[model samples]
Target: MASMARNPLPGTIRKDGRRAFYVYLSPPLIRELKKAALDEERPAYELVEEAVEALLKSRRIARPATDGVA
Candidate 1:
């Protein structure tokens, strides 16, 4: 079987140097993130960034000391 080439939908992703992806979140997780973000006075994306950074750290992904430092 041959796969057909298709153009990506606008806002789905980009042809530039940025990549975007999606994750399916359960309601409970969504609520948890919202509460935590509120407590920190930060956006949910900031929490997500911290999570990904922690994950990589746990897996021993090498990173510079200043990688997540402000």
Candidate 2:
């Protein structure tokens, strides 16, 4: 079976030099994200970033880069 960890989406840096990462989500998760973003009146990217940070902090997800090192 293919490992989920190896199924990351391709990402690239934006023209403005901001790093962007892509994550493929299921239809349900996409709907939840859109609803949450709208309810909070914030961009979906911002909510995504917050969720990612929380996950990293809780050790639920491992970041590509370790502290002060990539």
Q: Cα miss at 29, model 2 (Å)?
A: 0.6
User: Considering summed lDDT, which 10 consecutive residues are worst modelled in model 1?
Assistant: 1-10
User: How many residue pairs collide in each prediction?
Assistant: 0, 0
User: Candidate 1 clash total?
Assistant: 0
Question: TM-score of every model?
Answer: 0.58, 0.58
Please report, in order, the local distance difference test score of every candidate based on alpha carbons. 0.75, 0.75
| lDDT: worst 10-residue window of model 2 | 1-10
List model 2 lDDT by residue over 34-70, tens digit each: 9999999998988988987887777734555567653
lDDT of 1 by residue, 1-70 (tens): 1232255456755565345556999999999999999999998877997899898886664654556762
- Please report the TM-score between candidate 1 and the true structure: 0.58
